[model samples]
Target chain A: MKSLLQNLARWLVPVCFIAFSFSEEPYQLKLAMSWGSDFPVFSESPKRMAERVAKMSNGRLTIDVIGSEEHGRPLDVFDMVRNGEYDLGHSASYYWKGKVPNTLFFTTMPFGMLPLEQYAWLEHGGGQALMDEVYQPLGLLSLPGGNSGSQMGGWFQKRIKNTESLNGLKMRVPGFAGEVLSELGVVPTNIPATDLYEAMSRNVIQAAEFVGPSTDFNLKLHLAAQFYYTGWHEPGAELQFLINDEVYQSLPADLQAILKAAMRASAYDTYVHSVDVSAQAWADMRRQFPTIRVKDFPDEVMSELRRVNERKLVEFADDNDQARRIIESQLGYQAMMRNWTLLSDYSYLESIGR
Target chain B: MKSLLQNLARWLVPVCFIAFSFSEEPYQLKLAMSWGSDFPVFSESPKRMAERVAKMSNGRLTIDVIGSEEHGRPLDVFDMVRNGEYDLGHSASYYWKGKVPNTLFFTTMPFGMLPLEQYAWLEHGGGQALMDEVYQPLGLLSLPGGNSGSQMGGWFQKRIKNTESLNGLKMRVPGFAGEVLSELGVVPTNIPATDLYEAMSRNVIQAAEFVGPSTDFNLKLHLAAQFYYTGWHEPGAELQFLINDEVYQSLPADLQAILKAAMRASAYDTYVHSVDVSAQAWADMRRQFPTIRVKDFPDEVMSELRRVNERKLVEFADDNDQARRIIESQLGYQAMMRNWTLLSDYSYLESIGR
Candidate 1:
């Protein structure tokens, strides 16, 4: 009787397993991204989130990632990922302005919040959930994937004599910064990577900003634009992973965690690598482009730019409800940061004379 | 003549370095937080970041983080960090609803974006810059330093029956999700950690959502509430490292990058550890709380809750211009993600099922 009961219980366990697996239409999701085939983000953080979910359910739940731009161009990533054409896509949010203008705020801004400030606003300031409210109706899930530390201002061709020189100067600027520049009389232009070199060489654009020296040199823009500037307008630029909603819903809980963990790791790597390599890249660019004139924007020009920025912000706030909230939150944090900076950054620098 | 020039250049380099170091003013920064001195989030990331920055710059920069309710309650972290009363602080964003209503989007949301999503929105989606617009005037800077992935729903004394049960229910929730819950009629409360146990035990609050299994189990919530729920409303909850703008600006460029990089590493660790330990904690919880009932919220509840969420969204969007832009950008990304998830998550799962 004991043996029979034991045997029966074992068989019953499998039976129950099968029943549970079919409990609600077996939501098995496969999230494919190019970097890792289907689940590149899994490599960074929420490590093993996907795998854990799969194993817990005894193969009843599974999520796979396809990394690399195997599906399409990096630019096409946001659309492909969001439309459910692919399960997910890993690309920078700044790269998708054609789809969403404000999406670039998540990645970067010209002379805006650093990574930490961005984190505070997103988490405590109702930024993250607001984004979800924005995404869920479209059947998508968004996640922060990676970050690039303060970026080097883009390589430049000629010295910026004054704020006036920036006027009507066609440059490959994107997103809200572009809007701000346009307000400052800059002819902001958007060009894909393939066309950047030709544009600069032909003087179709006077200067351009592309990530840092590592990425900028990769495009060989240093050869065309001999003047390189610092102060990344898009400081704290971040990358993202876009996953389909239904597909994410299908994932087992554990797998979801793994995907998150992996992506976090990847993001760390991206930021670390960017920071470590950019400095070296800048050093190399100096050697490679000996004629490159490195100069900082004049204080007066910067002051004017700041003024224009304030006006544009107010205008944007007036035009867009969401922009108003963001500006309020951003300005709130900046006020605090400025007070802190004045005491710490300013005082320390004064003492050290750097 | 060559030797004299070389000697002059060497002396000039040292003098210039010294002058550069001392040229800037020092700003006072007071970082306040609720965690104990031993807490990793409060202690580790900032220490490493500051140490790394100082070392990289050969002691040209300095950062200090003080912990343990130094400012007041954990709920006050955002204000302290944002107001420049604290040069820096470690806290979750959801705690600051009184000031920045939309800030939670960067942290975690119910069935919303995960850590990766938070990063995505913050880094690429204009989330970072937008938040800066929120914080710049506040004199604050924020970076995501840690994350808790797919947290346990909460510890409850009674099982959640229908969506109606949420009405008038006192629950501890932070961020925009808290607002969503409020829309669903839940009384959202923000409580510091020290008070959670007493509040739950005394029936001051019937339900509470903490981080994950590890943190919850450690806090011994099972002793108070026997019913454990799955399906984390806030998956991949993020923790932020904040710095006063004054403090951040005071640092040298290289030091700033170093600090950013180190924080990135800490943020990565936070997620990895949470995901890894949660699994083990679940097993332990099962062993310890044999009578604990684990249940999932009814589908009807989720659907109804979502409907309420939509109403709140429209209302907020109509009122705030920034919210509107973010909604548009987020909606666009969501649409794209939906298509991607279908192909990657759904299609792959279906194939495996076959």
Candidate 2:
């Protein structure tokens, strides 16, 4: 009986305990990033997530982040990941608006909830489910990757006084904000990021929108524009982690949890980190380029832009049920959350009389 | 040869690979929460942490959360956890202010940074290291647990127009805010939470400050006082996760990572969740109790309160190097980050003209 037990144990070690070998060796995953390796917050967030996953999994899981420079195509990340060319991809959701119209709402809108408010909607107010509905159908799983706190309205050579100020102005603006600007007679032109500085410097384009101060600082945008306006678009631009569903399902349950938790933590950390970086960049801009003036759109200009944005949103959602649903969810959640914001943060901030 | 190899493998499996036993079997830790089991975001956060920890560890690590009801003494958590009586503890940092004065800085403060700004400080602006200086000495590890969004100033029967309105007023406000108010001739009283609603309704105390709308909804403070004032004190109250350092060191590298990541994700989720719940509570309060008026203190009263809060901060920081260091860090970070807030969030909100 002892001999038989010993023989059985030897066989069981190879067959029933294959999981030991799997756990002992690390599982390597490919993460395709839309941002270059040198990009500050955009690139750094994924590296942090990868590092956290490796540490937490005790080397059981490893994620290699391949940047846009290495991938050779930033815009193709979504399609490549969807086609299983990569196990994962990091990019903004709105980048896929042409491919999927409803995708725009997930990133941010002309005017929408702030990052925390949007997160509340995602976690507690059906935003995640709506997101899943959009992504799961395409064999992809989308998770919040990071936030840009708030995107600056853009850099402009001249202050925007009203709708007339936008008229006949050429700008390197894109997407939904571009569409809204076009309504006010701003000529939204597409300029490669590399030429954005030249375009603005040489009067090829008089206005532009990059990201927030941290990212815009990298573009040397301060050298190009004098007026830096506050944001009306992309109030809290959230990035996404795009995973191939089949590849995601192939992971062991423990690894899935590690991946999920790592992404979530890294996403929130990224937002706070973005805020810190923005603070530094803003301070730098003030100290180095005191010539730069920070401006807000006049109430009349803002109200007109808001009116046009509302009209565009209606048209944008008119055709698709999913689009309409997402729009309604965002609208309702923002309305309700804005009240709390007014009462808590806005009230507290104004009370200080700062 | 095969039979000899089988025999060798059987012998080696038990001796050469004892790790399987440790990995296959679970390591369970005890988590003692300062809040009751039924507590909203406070208790739910730890439970979420445990669940995520369990899932990520695949049962290799388990955390059993014990609420205050089970622990019997809520305020004793910091001492008990420090004494190694519990493996972990979840409570507000300020609870230990009497024992460790510097700890009061960790939770929240009057005229301090908001939740997100404070998070930025903790993550990027050397706040965590300063926190480590305070905690590492106690043989404990304190981490960012969750944020209470913004704590409301409190409930009042009437508007606070000026310093005269504060004179001789009996209120159940506690901690640093209470100290500042007392300096302004207001009488601060200690009342048990269970008796708070009765105290306010029966005119035992004219006013009281609970948590924000979410947690305060449970206390039904609106039923006691007609005027619901916005927050000034405890701008963003952060809760803490207390871990026995030695117990933490005993965990495997993977489990440690899992633990840290789980806590972080849960902390952020709690803040967002708190926001959602607060929105619901505020909406409910508006619809059900239309008589409850929301007000901010007059600018004169606010400036006076701010002056006293700043004065008390200087006094609070005196004599303690760590306390002074923490205060200087907060004040400086707040001053810098407040610019970003005004340019981004505050500016955008104002542009909406809502």
Candidate 3:
């Protein structure tokens, strides 16, 4: 009788295990991204996230990443995910500025905090909660996907002798930055992404603002102009991941944890990967293009630009209550954190004198 | 007959599921850390890693983190993990430098690469493989556990007048930094961690090197002396996680994936968390301790320190063949990445000039 009862208990345990673990069908999520296929370090975030999630879930959950080229709607990721056409998205938060003005603050700002400092604000200084507040109402969730370090000033057709050289320069700068440049007697124009090379080569635009060396070299923007300027516009541009709220709620707690942890790790890895890629590309650029001049805007020009930036920030505060709140929070946090930044990495670099 | 066959198939499916999932006993690994219990951000990595792993693995694989207080062995983490007394450890690589001289290069060095630069080297510049080469022989695996940004020059009892102020200064600094200081007419010595406050307050040491404000403030080391100098030694110090090779190999592939992913996320999180904590702590310290004065070592002293640091690095290379390889790789990589750093973050800071 004891042997028979033990046998019955063993069979019951297996039955319970199967029903609990394998009863749910394997989950396959469709992810929409802003960039086209194989977009170098930028697209690697979703790819790695998918790979990690599949492994962590023991193949129980998988992600199918579709780039903008395949999806035929690069800029519609926000709409697609919100409408449930895609389970998630990988894109920059600033892309939705027309519809959601607060989204612009989450990415980089002109003369704003660097990546580490910005991350500190986001993670601990209420930036994340503000980000959550903006996205939660739209049935979407946003998290930091990656950072591409600091963007360079631009590839200028001619060497800048002083701050006044930018006064009459025709440049291909867009949106908020364009407005800032316009205040300094410069003519800023928005050119389509595909026309950037042609515009710069033909002197239609005398200078172009792209990314740092990695993506810039890929675009051969430096080939059009050899003078690369150090950046102040977009200090540290951060990419973001967008998840649909309903889809997120549907996952079991374990799977949800796996998804978040994988995304966090992938996000961090992407930043480090960008650092490596940009460093190598910058070195290669210098070696290949011996004429490449890396110049910083003169202190007077920098000081003037910051003054304009501060004025623009005051106008930006009038957008709405939420915008006012985020801008104030970021400014306050940056002021507090900048003291330490000056004392730490900035001071360390100065002391090393490297 | 068909209904009976269907019933049999259901039973067999469960049997297979039981064998594949939840078939083994729950994996509970003992992780020994080098810090005492509840050691703030330093201990948060393993604690969070264990929490994340438990959730990701659905409680099948749980880690029991025992700090040095409970384990009764703070300095023996590497040995404890290797001897199978603990499956893993959280500590600095330099802690093992006395036993394995090559271990000195893994943590931050005097005038070495900063955190991001070193991470770029480790991830893409063959640093991971080189680190593995050093550790694989000891039946241990090491990975970056966290970074505390940068170490500050010790708090001094008296204000520095100039570059020559450090001459004949008695300070409580240990290991490689102590060796470098000894060359510059400063007396360097190591005191136990607990007695640092007493020694500094009693004038046993004129200055003391703890960590940045987060841990340093917690230690109340700043209270004894208020003239804080900027750091040159141990810039961007990174802590490490050590895993026993045999124990690591015993886990299933999915569990291994979960363990690694958790540690990576935890490590990155710890660094960001430190930035936030230190930033906040520095802000609070300035407000609460208005008497505190932050000073930078004069340019002449900084230049001389770098010259001596370069020489010491040459001597460090002669420690072993592997040490030579790591030192060369670090120096070469730092040279390459520092250009980008100067152009990007450094230039950005200068332009903003906040």
Highest lDDT: give the candidate number: 2
DockQ, all models: 0.02, 0.52, 0.54
Best model number under TM-score:
2
Give the docking tier of candidate 1.
Answer: incorrect
- Fnat per candidate, as a fraction, reads 0.02, 0.66, 0.66
Order the candidate numbers by TM-score, best to worst.
2, 3, 1
Q: What is the lDDT of residue A334 in candidate 3?
A: 94
Per-candidate Cα lDDT values, in order, are 0.60, 0.88, 0.87
**Between candidates 1 and 3, the TM-score winner:** 3
lDDT for predicted candidate 1 compared with the true structure: 0.60
Docking class of 2: medium
What TM-score does model 2 achieve against the real structure? 0.95
How well does chain B match by TM-score in each candidate? Answer: 0.79, 0.93, 0.93
lDDT of 1 at A11: 49
Worst 10 residues of 2 chain A by lDDT: A15-24
TM-score of each: 0.47, 0.95, 0.94
Chain B only: TM-score of model 1: 0.79
Which is the winner by TM-score between candidate 1 and candidate 2?
A: 2
